[model samples]
Target chain A: MSTVQITRLSMPKWGLSMTEGTVVQWLVEEGTILEQGDEVIEVESEKINNAVESPAPGVLRRQVAKEGDVVPVGGLLGVIADAEVPDSEIDAFVEEFEATFVPEEEEAAGPEPEKVEIGGKSIQYLKMGESDATPLVLIHGFGGDINIWVFNQETLSTERPVYALDLPGHGGSVKDVGSGDLDSFAGIVAGFLDAMGIEKAHLAGHSMGGAVAAAIAIQHPERVASVTLIASAGLGEEINSDYIEGFIAANRRREMKRVLGTLFANPDLVTRQLVNDVLAYKRLDGVDEALRAVADSLFPDGKQANVLDISRIQAPVLVIWGDKDEVVPASHAQNASSGAKVETIENAGHSVQMEAAGKVNRLISGFLDEAES
Target chain B: MARRITFMQAINEALAQEMERDETVVVFGEDNAGGAGAPGEDDAWGGVMGVTKGLYGKYPGRVLDTPISESAFVGAAAGAAASGLRPVAELMFVDFFGVCMDQIYNQAAKFRYMFGGKAVTPMVIRTMFGAGIRAAAQHSQSLYPIFTHIPGLKVVVPSNPYDAKGLMIASIRDDDPVIFFENKVLYSVEGDVPEESYEIPLGEAEYVREGDDVTIVAIGRMVSMAEQAADALEDEGVECEIVDPRTTSPLDEEAIYESVENTGRLVVVDESNPRCSLASDIAALVAQNCFDHLKAAPRMVTAPHTPPPFSPALEDLYVPDPERVAAAVRETLGTSDRARA
Candidate 1:
């Protein structure tokens, strides 16, 4: 008799903040064969829902964790082994694994988001990965903070250092928006780079942040290496005035749910936790005034107030949009500079980066590679 | 950005931010600023556990280190509040309340009523309580009930770091005297807390877990224990709704009544002794308000009528555990308790 090899399928850490996940369902059953990259199970974390893929090809020996079980990250969810393995051997392996398995303390301190004062205002940012490659800077859209990049930051940082920043009026940054105009917001982005001593780097912006990025590329082209815009705002004249007004006016939970429903093509993606987070942020003092100032300055009569001439942008640009986006139409993708490459994702809404994370990540990575070469 | 911090750190941040925001706010307690007159470090010990450690240096003259005389300082805090300053006096251990009962209950708690509503005692008494860490009988007691028993006093018992920070800020800003109880065992427990100061209003009951079968109303550290029990019961197809009444005085009776009416079953897990406790109070409230809605007699899981013991084995039995809470919930569901027996 020959011994068989075995592999344990454990819950994966999808992002920096995910400490545990609830097993939603098992896509594969026991005694079934699986190939690498096959979706084996569905897991739901507080932030997002994603499927766990198999790491190696094998027969599904046993499902150690049942559906609906909330297991800590790295806890064994199932076992995969060659068909030659005896049931007795699999049982022994699982027994030993369970006896020695100690869940890591979820609250163990990790790299924390830091704050720096620039121009007498506090700016919050998170820096991940360490590489000599040109650093990537992420700027969030209107009413968003660094958290909007939660899905893309860790993945992109693997090959190069990445910094996700909260503009003055968002996230943990100071709530005061000095002028709430593209020039004022863009100047703060430049000041952030100067504060960090980064002379030039790639800039990726979403929605309103895209406008800030375009403004920087136009006025201070020497500081920008490349630009990637997701459902950008500066290239078009038409804007969803209803979304702007609804987002600012909605204070109750039900109202918030309705307003946030516009951000996703599948409204089911809007969970209770997401609504609670937005409400908590809005309740903070000075946030209301800051948001109102930005909205009044940028979108005066339900229209884009700072539409930029995309043809004059000097940096290599990549434009990505969601075909079903309701906030900013996908038609705006055609307005990009002739040199820009454009891609529109189907079955996604305004939050294309989050709705189609894998595709967006691949597209951005490919664009960055070409720009670097 | 929100970051994980210990319960003690949250309290400290709340005090520091409140003091910075309002010059009228001042902190004074025994060893809140250690080595006040000694030749060594001036701010050596922030408190017994250093909950107020760095505030002395930040505010300079605002944070004071008082002698071990609780009555004098507590009375002085009340007098200072009446005179205009919002004083937050630490009682060190709530067991020491005997020495300062007159100052807290008679003077501070009754001033507004006796002075034709002209007096405003904006004072806070922060103290540590609860049995754990082997801190014998006198040092460990869940005495928030005693404070909650008094009229004109707002009692706050926060379970996690987020609630601790918010409740502390609200207490400091409140115009009435407030008693803030800290569970010593929960000092090191961590949770996500916002860097910016925010206030959670008094008398709001937070539904920690939403379910349909039973409503579990818990207080202070017991909230975490009830959550643990709720998770375990979930596997057995027993769903539970857990509620944390952040404030004992001005209790959110409406939240409890609504949850109990929906679930039709009630189980209260409290760390204090069973006699005349918050558990008994809440159970009574539910029985009176939702009598027709209940499916079974309300169950209470609490420490025995005796004081907290000293031996580790006995202390383990003294504190309510998740197993005991689950058994009580099962009893309310008319399930057999013979399995545990």
Candidate 2:
């Protein structure tokens, strides 16, 4: 094999169902050095408008997918290499790559999320990177599922196995939220870990998921090696109750679109796909009741019903918050114990993992690595 | 452009387009994938009625075929939706809702309100309804009113292929739990449906035909009857406005009120039994909201309060037809009054 350092800027899959996306703009021109995680190109999928950061540190050699070009998932979008790489080789590589790239059969064959029976309910989960290393289980907050980790899961899984779960009453997991409480959800998570045969895991949660993770750390400490909280609830006394209530009550497109806007700092992140997705979920049979129970039991008003003391957490804790989080207040981070290495991300909101995946991933990976060491 | 496709095809196309546009949209029901088991023709039956045909081949695992357990799969669809998936569960027939209504009425409906407005359960339950096809009582019934009675649920009864495709697409994309009732008899009735994905906002009424003499608001299959009545009425010099309220839960009260406001005479046509049917509902709405707009008391043309007869002649008579609809409109605008004056 010829030793040639190459950067594969393939079409980015922002979410599970995004088979194609349009290149919105390129922030950096060709022939520029890009450190890993550096923003290079911004892309717009049906569900989100996200910036594709450099996966590896290298020179951005060529701009393959120009602005406004819609490319299929796995399609070659660009290339990166050291300045020493021959121009002729780069040209030949691009030609060969384009010639051989076959858009997978139009038969809808893509990543298949699996559902396993955990605690007498169907648990939907997406697992990536088949490493024997301790798996990282991502649990999303209220009204969220594995799709919320679409950006972070694939990136973080490169070093170790990563699994994103749709907690009960969320995602493809069971809708029967037995108690519709944090403890009930924690039990379900622990049961899922047991069913997956995972002895220990780095648990990461967003919003209400943070409380679920905290509950797990307190009750089933042995199963959790570390914890990462992103814009989590249960940390503060204040939450945007209006947003929650509006999200639950808004059934029409205009109403739902307006309600979902409150989750992000930019508000633009609540794309049409996101609204449609949330609406589709809301139409399911028992989902509404389960959601209502969770909402009433967890956060009755603007205040969180289940607040766990992070200082009592046995595992190493890493609390990540968006400085401008609108749904969950950013000041909640101050309540976290000083022992917990808390990082408040700027220009991010409640969905820090999606808004600033690169920064959040590095923080998560660094914390996970430290725990393993 | 409008093209002819089976009712099943219309539902399938609606689902396929919606899923393509929205990744969170998913489809699951009994035998939705067809040949999940057995040796011959792995993709055996797309569905019992084959309405979901070809979708399995196109969407693969997303078009899930569940066990005959409606409660389990329906509840699972609801559960999956609460978590992340925007699942569309097929009940096969509205009559089978008895086995799994708790998921729809209690669970899916209550999510938004009971959650203190923190939960959004965007889901759709599509089922075949109405009398015809010799499917008998168990398979045939107009149950939209039952669903419409529920505050949280949005009940949809598409009148034709165009409405079927657009309304089904809208139901899939809608944020609330919508009971999309497809008339089994009208599935084969072809009409224009746009290939590109578009949503016809729920609770909006469609003016099938404009008229000056009398306003005839119809539901589901009866809208076609009313349209035919309007065509016949046009030849007789009596114009009639035909309105189709695609959804009943988010009832187009404004549409009914507006038509009444304009025509000053109303005739509501419904295929369901007269008592407590969409006809009565519309009449009550007009009386309560647009009472001053009426030139005469509103008239309701509907099937008598009785189980649909199996005899073709009786069944045909039992359902509201163009003649009955035209007569109701004529009564609302009596030519004798003009002749006498």
Candidate 3:
């Protein structure tokens, strides 16, 4: 018999505020051989419901947490090991791991999102990981905040520093979107990089943020290293005007839930907490005017207003589109320049990064590796 | 970014933001601007405790400093509100309501009804109450029950900084008269508050902690005390569901009844005196609405029927603590009876 390695599958911290999660169901049972990035179990928090992916290739040995049992962050959920490992040794490993486990209090406290003033506006951003690698800055879509990257930010931060920023009129940032056009939005992103003392960095933007990223590449090409657009706008001239109107008009939970359902392929992703968070953001003092201004400037007469000339971008570009996207159609992926690589993800919607986070993360990591080399 | 701030700071922010947003919004009270006409300096005190400090300089003439007369200023506030200005009048201490009872109950509160629904009196009476500091009998008193008893008035007693900010904004924007009660002891307590303005609707109860064994309803500062008791009870395998009714006038009756029906046991923690207070009011509510589902008689943890004591030691015993609240929960569960026997 050979020595076996056991991998403890623990509950993950999805966002800054998540303290515990309930195991809704197990997608893969004990003794099932799992590959890395394969779906292992489905977990539900107050914010959203997403499937937990396997971190390593192994055989599932024990399901420690039962279905419907709520487990605190960092609590053990299951164990994965080589199939050749004896049952006695696996049991001993589980016992010893449980006996020695101590939760980190500081991790529970977590780091608060920091705010910086750029051009007289308060911009809030959350930074994770610390490395000398060229940093990646994440800009959220219209009516969204840094929280839209709740699934990808922490994972992407493992290799290098990742900064997820709340643009003007979103999240904890100042609710003043000056001009509310692509140029102004991109200028703020450039200002954010300047405030953070970052000379040049990779930009990953979603939805309207994608247009902003493209604008940054066009206007301030010196500040951008590469660009990644996910379900981005400005690629074509057609948008679902009803979604924008509904989101801006939604005030109550029920109306907000209906509006947010358009973002995800599975409407169940729009939980009550999600709807409440959006409502809270919308209720902020200047959010209504800011959102209206952006919508009017970007989507006029139910069509995309600013179509970017992507061929002028000097940096390498990766454009991701969800085949099932209702907001921006998948057909727009063809509009990318010949130099840009476009990948269309299936079974996802406008929120493809959250719905298919594993695939998206792998794609981004590989693209970043290639770009750096 | 969202950051932790004291309950007092939250109130100040609400006032500042509302005044900045609406030109019709005005603030006035005794010493709200500190040195109104003193020989030393301008904008002197900013109120008894510095809750309204720095606003006088920011708003110029909007933040006013008035004489220490509750009846006159409160009445003036009602008049100004009815005449198209939104005024937030600070009553200094809630115990002084005796001097201003007529203005609050008769005029401001009844304006909309008296004027055949045409009058929109947008007035907020901000007052300090509760016992914690050695304030003695004259200053510290929870008189929310009196305001809650009024038909046309909306009484709000927020427990933390987040609720304090939200409820204050809601009160300022409300078309009717609102009595915004601030607990003196809780002024320094800190909680996370968002920088941007948001309003928590009145008449909704927030479930602070969810459980299944016993339902604990708390009001004002007592909400924190009940939360502490609930956490301790969890250690002994007794789960408690804690609810905070942010407003007393627009009481969330359905939440209380649903919680009582689910848990079958109820415990109410109120810092006010035992008789004719929020404790008795909620106990009567649960007993009447969920009588068939109740497993045991509802219990109330409150101060005895007397004035707030002056001495620190006596005052410590006068207020309801976590132990008292936990003991009351145990009593409702019949576990305390076993210990007594």
Clash number for candidate 3:
4
TM-score of chain A of 1: 0.86
DockQ of each: 0.18, 0.05, 0.36
Q: What order do candidates take by TM-score, descending?
A: 3, 1, 2
Which of the numbered candidates is closest to the native, going by highest TM-score?
Answer: 3
How close to the true structure is residue A321 of candidate 3, measured as C-alpha lDDT?
A: 82
TM-score of each: 0.72, 0.58, 0.85
* Candidate 1 lDDT tens digits, B1-341: 68899999999999999999999999999988764553444446788888998888889899898888999999999999999999999999998999999999999999999998999999999999999889889988898888889999999999999999989998999999999999999999999998888777788777787777889999999999999999999889787899999899989998898789888889998888888899899999999999999888999999999989998889889999999999988888884432222
Per-prediction TM-score of chain B?
0.96, 0.93, 0.96
lDDT per residue as tens, model 2, A22-104? 78899998999999988899888878888888889889999999886778988888898888998888898899998899875
Supply the global lDDT for candidate 2: 0.82
Candidate 3: tens digits of C-alpha lDDT, residues A1-373: 5667888888888888887888889998799999988889989887888888888899988999888677888889998899888888888877997898886564476657999998999889999989999999999999999999998999899888899999888888888888888888888899989988898899999999998999999898888889999999989998999999999988755678788889988888776678767876787767888999989988988888999988889999999988889999989889999999899988898999988888888888889888889
Clashing pairs in 3: B34-B44, B34-B45, B34-B46, B35-B44
